[model samples]
Target: MHSKELLKGTLQMIILKLLADEGKMYGYEITQKVKELSDGQMVLTEGALYPTLHKLEAEGLLITEKVSMGKRIRKYYRLTETGQSSVLKKVDEFTDFISMMSRVLQIKPAL
Candidate 1:
């Protein structure tokens, strides 16, 4: 897995992009999906994940709903309307930033 320092800056954007693509997802499910999608190169720890999730919720970009499973309550998160709209801007900005950085570094754009 990459260092937290490497992942830290992009975590929120990553979460937003994932939630934007996948709709609602619970915390563990989000982590697992990330690991699966990244082929285990990025693992999100609860320490980092929960605070980001809480911050996004507090910021009104995300809303949480709790559902009781057989024995445990699971909190699922989805984008608010604002979040849904903001994600496109975030993704586009990040993409452009990456493109610019790649140009400076003389590396090919990943996508």
Candidate 2:
């Protein structure tokens, strides 16, 4: 598993990118998807995930819908229009940052 410190900084970007691609997902589903995508290398705890999700919703970058699932009500999150645009910008910024760091560290740039 990746260190919490490393995962901490990238969590928001990771969430945004996933929402952009997946359309909408609930908290647990997001956690599972991250784990699957990273081949179990990355796992997000509810402690870390919910706060970030709430923060994004408070910032008006995300909107939620509640759906009935068997005996429970599940809250699903989707990006707002502002969020859609922001994802592209954030992804580009993160890409550039990685490229710059790779160059500085004399490592091959990430694809």
Candidate 3:
């Protein structure tokens, strides 16, 4: 698994992109999706996940709706119009960052 330090900087972008792709997702769903997509190499604990979600919601990049499942309520998050645009920008920026990092680290494509 990758270290938390590596994951820290990209967590917001990850969550935003996932919501943009999936339309809407609850907290646990987001965590599981990240783990699945990363082949279990990245795991998001509740401690790391919820605060980011709350911050996004506060920033007007995301909105949430609560639905009841049996005795519990699940909060589902989806991108706002601002978030939709932000996803495109963030993806482009992250792509550039990766390219720059590769150059700095002298990483080359495998055959």
Candidate 2: the clashing residue pairs are none
Which candidate do you rate higher for lDDT, 1 or 3? Answer: 3
- How would you encode candidate 1's per-residue C-alpha lDDT over 1-111 as one tens digit per residue? 688897888888989999999999999999999999999999999999999999999999999999999899999999999999989898899889988998899997468
Q: What would the per-residue lDDT of candidate 3 be over residues 1-111, giving only the tens digit for each residue?
A: 887887988999999999999999999999999999999999999999999999999999999999999999999999999999999899999999999999999999888
Model 2, 1-111: lDDT tens per residue? 778998989899999999999999999999999999999999999999999999999999999999999999999999999999999999999999988998899997458
Report the error of model 2 at residue 108, Å: 2.9
Model 3: residues with Cα > 4 Å off, grouped in runs: none
The deviation in Å at residue 90 for candidate 2 is 0.6
Better of 2 and 3 by TM-score: 3
Where does model 1 exceed 4 Å of error?
109-111
Clashing pairs in 1: none
| Each model's Cα RMSD | 1.7, 1.5, 0.7
Better of 1 and 3 by TM-score: 3
Candidates ranked by lDDT, best first? 3, 2, 1
Query: Which residue pairs of candidate 3 clash?
Result: none
Deviation in Å, model 3, residue 75 alpha carbon? 0.6
